[model samples]
Target: MSRREFTQAIDFRHGRVDMTHGGGGRAMAHLIEALFVKHFDNALLREQNDGAAFALPPGTGRMVMATDSHVVSPLFFPGGDIGCLSVHGTVNDVAMAGGQPLYLAAAFIIEEGFPLADLERIVVSMARAAREAGVPIVTGDTKVVEQGKGDGVFITTTGIGVAAPGIELSGDRARPGDAILLSGSLGDHGVAIMSARENLALDSDLVSDTAALHRLTAAMLECAPGLRCLRDPTRGGLASVLNEFADQSECGMHLREEAIPVKPQVAAACEILGLDPLYVANEGKLVAICPPEDAERLLACMRAHPQGRDAAIIGEVTADPNHFVQMSTRFGGVRMVDWLTGEQLPRIC
Candidate 1:
């Protein structure tokens, strides 16, 4: 088809997209060549393999690989969409293990009747995120389904990273007297998504804290190489994450209610939604544990960084072999910070 004909045949602004775009026909090829490739173009992606392959960096010790699928409703939500969320989510997952994210692979499942303009916007956002994070989208696949078979779009992302020599950290590493630190305020991402999806009343300032946490991780690791554990409080939130550590490490935990950070707006939104901020999801925050001796130094390092400016020493590992998480309430009462049993919200990234 001639350029004019192709341009005329495919609607860019107001076109109602169809399944043919994923049918491996001229339309499909045109979309890939014109949009996806244009922005994510790189030496690795240009080769187009089922997976990316490359030599490891010298001194690379442990290899870390993490995969996450993004099916957030509304496709676009406050502060971020599925595209940027996919990139940051996987990056944070890998970084939580004290790894430096090196590469990313993405796959898109798009609805047939979705808008081309929206798809282009999402892909561009993904490109920008990958570039800004210094992680390349080395390989990817795109599949289309009938209108009813899919949401607007779903993204599956896998990240590969490398850990430095001799560094060891795991859920089972938490021990009594170890200090627990939170990167920043909690529940911002989940509440933002909830408000956006329901069209609930909210201030424009309320937004999802979606960001890459690898740099902040590096800073913390540098200051506290004795860091025992690292985890981004994601799906199950802070309570679940701490419970997992306690169970695995065969240790109990004690948290200071006043030390755990939660933004006032997020706290208010969670109260209105009948949700506990402890059970709400967070995209840009993380939980880190280190030797008691390393706590102050690590907090200082975290505070010096922009992403972790609100870092706080919320708790400490306990001696109980039963592995319970307890908290010192703001009102001077001690309470159990148990595992989260119910879903706080669904389709929340």
Candidate 2:
């Protein structure tokens, strides 16, 4: 059939995806034009080429890249969905490197019989997130699998960014006496997902903390150019991030339990679920380590941002032969914050 004929023949309103959508035939083209393109209409994507082509301005600085896959069950959540999560995850990954994200590329795997309406909603959410972050989805690919072989949809997003000169952030950069900073409250995203998945009755205010962190990172960079390291505490929450820093820098981390921020609702939900907030997950929050002297200025800078209003100095790096992570309890005790043994919450991101 001709392109116009195919476009007119698609029943987007009542249709469900079949294997033909991934057959790379007319059906695929119709789906792309009607759904994906209609929502994510950007110049690079409008070219409809296999890949996006562009030139960077002179002195844009070192280029950074990051990629993430989103298989979170329940496509829709209280504060976000798989679509926004895919975008935020990769964008934050690049930003954690002290980079300003530039563009994004997405790939989708959709199960056969997935609803067109849900797919459209996901695509729209993705577009809005990329736009808000000032990053456009430049190119992408879509595939459909057998009904039972795949979940409703899985999205993988790849991000590209440019790091400013004199800005270097890595796990190994932390040194003894470096202050450990947390961007905000912990376990918000994890609690939100668990509550929604288990049908738990909780306060209506709970929602995923998924968000882009490039702006907040930029602000902190301005105040503390010597920022030692930056990491987003995502999959394993705060505990996992501290452990990673300890291992990478070959230094121990000492966290103050009272200093780490956790909302009352989130903490209560964790208690009912028999989960530790530190072992839970967060998307928007970050773990930053800076020189002790720079900590005050940096903390003030972070607090000035909307995303970092609840930022605090939760801990500090220490010299230790074993490179362990230990936290001081509020009751005047201390315990090890080891690496997550098993998957606490699978497919969370």
Score each candidate by Cα lDDT. 0.89, 0.91
Evaluated at residue 34, the lDDT of candidate 1 is 73
Q: Which stretches of model 2 miss by more than 4 angstroms?
A: 1-9, 198-204
Per-residue lDDT tens digits for candidate 1, residues 211-302, read: 99999998888888889999999988999999999999999999999998889998888778788899899999999999999999999999
Which candidate should be chosen as best, given TM-score against the real structure?
Answer: 2
Write down the TM-score of every candidate. 0.95, 0.97
Off by over 4 Å in 1: 1-10
For candidate 2, lDDT tens digit of each residue in 169-268? 9999999999999999999999888878856666657999999999999999999999989999999988998999999999999999999899998899
Q: Which ten residues in a row have the lowest lDDT in candidate 1?
A: 1-10
Q: Pick the candidate with the highest lDDT.
A: 2
